[model samples]
Target: MRLALAQLNPVVGDLRGNAERILAAARSASAEGATLLLTPELSLWGYPPRDLLLQPARLALQSAVLDGLVEQLDGLCSLLVGVALPCDDDRAPGLYNGIALVDQGGWRGVARKQLLPSYDVFDERRYFRPGDGPCLLTLEEGERLGLTICEDLWVEDALQRERLAGPDPIAALVEAKPDLLINLAASPFDPSKPALRRQLAGQAARRLNCPVVYLNQVGGNDELVFDGSSLVVAPDGSTLLELPACREAVQVWDSSGPQQATAPLSQTPCREELLLRALVLGVRDYAGKCGFQRALLGLSGGIDSALVAVIAAAALGPENISALLMPSPWSSSGSINDATALANRLNIKTHTLPIQGLMQGFDTSLTPALGQQPQGVTAENLQSRIRGTLLMAVANQQGQLLLTTGNKSELAVGYCTLYGDMNGGLAVIGDLYKTSVFALCDWIDSPEARNCREDLGLPQQGELVGEAIRRKPPSAELRPDQKDSDSLPDYSELDPLLKGLIQERTTPQALVAAGHDIPLVERVQRLLQRAEFKRRQAAPLLKVSPQAFGSGWRLPIAAGGLCSAGPD
Candidate 1:
């Protein structure tokens, strides 16, 4: 039997459109003589449809789409499509994430996801009802194929492992001796996730001595983006066909013989490449899915904005990106020149809107009420707000979306000006740190970025032509002669401290005690705790790490903690 695994990127809630995409893939696979075409979990309504499942009308609409799918794609191939179905004897008559085995023979089998993931980014316990029975359906050829949704395969509890782990998917499939062990998954992207998944599939296939085909969804859905790195592992545990993560690939597997390994686990790109690809896809999907062709941002001549500009150019075309250089009295000549050089090098449209007059007007009106110069943080924030206002104006007029350019480091410390640089529809690098941001930029500027630029034919050959953005010390440039290191410890010093205080899972007092410099640690720790409110208000960032704000890490809004050297 020839089976096809269709790794798709479907927009959430677009039932008709998603069905069309699925049908097209099925047709393409069947033309090549594939008998069965398996799709990722929840391909019709998209995975983790979240609260949309709560609405009966929405589920009914999805049900209508699923019914149409059963009619439309039957004769082409035996299709296994995932969708939300009303549960049998459910407590509230709610829905379950289910798969329908459909063919010209009509729908033959259904399998609800058994293990609903509740940790990390998944909250499936709030919605789905687990299936009680193990499904082993007989195909037209009188061969049985075991069916299981994503989380069901990974489930292992102490009690279950001890008592009934014998009915594991691979073990059960081996016992039943099915023609193929096909799974439907809606896996999200983590830097290390795909490797573990590939290893597990390869190991399981070898142990069961049967071919295993896994299908995963691709594309960004709100806060989570599914990277489709679908592949087939032969019965011998060798990878016959492999598709890289973050792209759409539909691969056919021959169940008759063993195949050679074309690529090993080592083919996965480096972290820099992984992150660059992720951001590019994130920006592309966010902009394209949101129906915006263009993006605008205030380029402050710093590495953060410059890196964001490069990503925007990669995501949207260089021509579709708009760069604005807003200078105030505090703006330096070096900054103005750097901003212009970077914009010109990128080939993006640029405009200069000096905020001197605007700042003056606001200052004059508020002088009497304040009776003092707008100095320090307030004054610096005013400049940022002015630039943000101008950028939003351009965005409104030109029908473009504003992209926020702050990195996680600054967001962690509340260094960014709220409602100013933070005013945008999406945060490109909000989940990345100041350090990782630089590394990604360097990779983009490397010879590799030139050779393997996106399919759009954007010229990355010159590769970040200007040296200023690369060499300049990172800074907000909100105040005259200001540098980030002056206010906080050097990134080399502060990053590890921040990581210990947050990322490394160390306690505040322990972090101070672990140390090289206690005062700096305390200062950094204090900023981290106080910055909670700021981080709370910030937009959702694409999380590259295991822990990022609003997802893995959740802290209290109130200042309530125990430590002499508190999360200061």
Candidate 2:
């Protein structure tokens, strides 16, 4: 039997639209002689429908959408569609994250998701009741098919540092002797996730002694970006087929059909290349889904903004991207020149808005209240706020989505000002550390990024980020001769410490034991905790790392039991 994987991108709450997307993929797969089409988990309503699942009206609409599919998909092919199954009994959470088998006869709930992930960006447990046990769907031809949803296949204790406690769906399926195991997912992108997913599928395939197909949803939903690197693994743990990442695809596989020369497995791109594509996809979907045709950013000639400019050009075409050069009096001529040069290279439109006058005016207005001019950090922040206000005004007038260019390091330490440089609808690289920003910029200027650039519809020739921007010392240019190092540790040192504290969740004492300076570690820890208010108010950033500040990091703004002192 030919099995098809329909990797789709669905908009949350758009039941009709999502159902149509499923049918389109189903029709295309049936045309290619596929007998069964498998879609990602919750493909009908999109993943993490969140509060939308609570509305009785939308749940009722879900039923109507499924009915439409039953009629339109008749005689085409049997399909396994992910859905929310409503229970009639008085279960606290009335819905089960489920899969349905739809064919000429009708549709029925076949397999429900056993593991409902609650950690990080997922809150599935809030809306779903876990399935009771393993599910086995027997086809008309008496072919037994084992079924599971996203987290069901992620039971490997060794691969993951922590495993979800639940019934082992794969283990239960071992005695069922199924011909195939299919796991539907809406797994978001993390640099380590692709390989980890493949390994998980391979292990399940070997355990079941049958082919395992893992289909994942692709595209950006809010802050989460899913890279659909779906795959099929043979019983021997070798990959039989692998789909492309960061896009939608539908392809069929037949083991009984004539054997052709097996193609080499596709290699995952370098970290920089993967990140660029993921971010571009994130930005593109975020803007398109939010009804923004153009994007605006405050281009400071700094590495962060320069990289965002390149990404914006790639995501929403160069013609649709606009940059505002809000240079203060202290801004260097070289910085201004660099910003203009970078914009010219990417073919994005740029407008200069000198904020020197605005800075003086603010000082004049505030002097009467304080009986003195706003000085030091107060003065520096005024410059940022002036630029932010101008960017917001332009974005509003032009109907462009404002993109924030702050990196993770600055954000982690509260180095950025509130309602100032941190202002935007989306933070493009808020998960990327300042050091990673430099590395990505360097890669953008290198030959390796050329092909990815061309594929992303960006300019492929010459240096995209340029050497001057890449080599310049990191600075906000808020004050004369001001550098980031003046206020914070060097990125080379700070980023690792930040990563340890944020991603690794290392204690200050543990960090100190690991050779980070005790005083610096404690200071960084305090800054990170104190900056929670700012992060809480910041824009939703594109999540590239496993732990980003948005939705996922649920630290309290007003709590502290921070550990003190270095390791003995």
lDDT of 1 by residue, 1-568 (tens): 7888888888888889988998998899998888888889988888767777787777778767767777886568878888776766758536677888777655634777776777667777788766666667677687667777776555344212222222465555567676666678998776776766666677667756666777788877766767787777787766777666777877777676556664454466777777777777878888888899999998888889998898899888898999888988877888889989888888898899999999888788778889976877888889898888898889999999899999888988888877898888888888788887777778777877664564435575676735667788887777777889878777777777777766666766786677646666667777888989888787777766666776656788797653456454
Question: For this target, which candidate reaches the highest lDDT against the unseen true structure?
Answer: 2
lDDT agreement with native, every candidate: 0.77, 0.90
What TM-score would you give candidate 1 relative to the actual structure? 0.92
lDDT of 2 by residue, 314-430 (tens): 899999999999887888999999999989888889999888888889989999999999999999888888888999999999899999999999999999999899999999999
Residue pairs clashing in model 1 are 526-568
Candidate 2 has its poorest 10 consecutive residues by lDDT at: 255-264
Please estimate how well model 2 matches the true structure, expressed as its whole-model Cα lDDT.
0.90
Any runs in candidate 1 off by more than 4 Å, and if so which? Answer: 155-174, 177-179, 262-266, 454-456, 509-516, 562-568
Model 2 residue 429 CA deviation in Å: 0.2
Model 2 TM-score, all chains together: 0.98
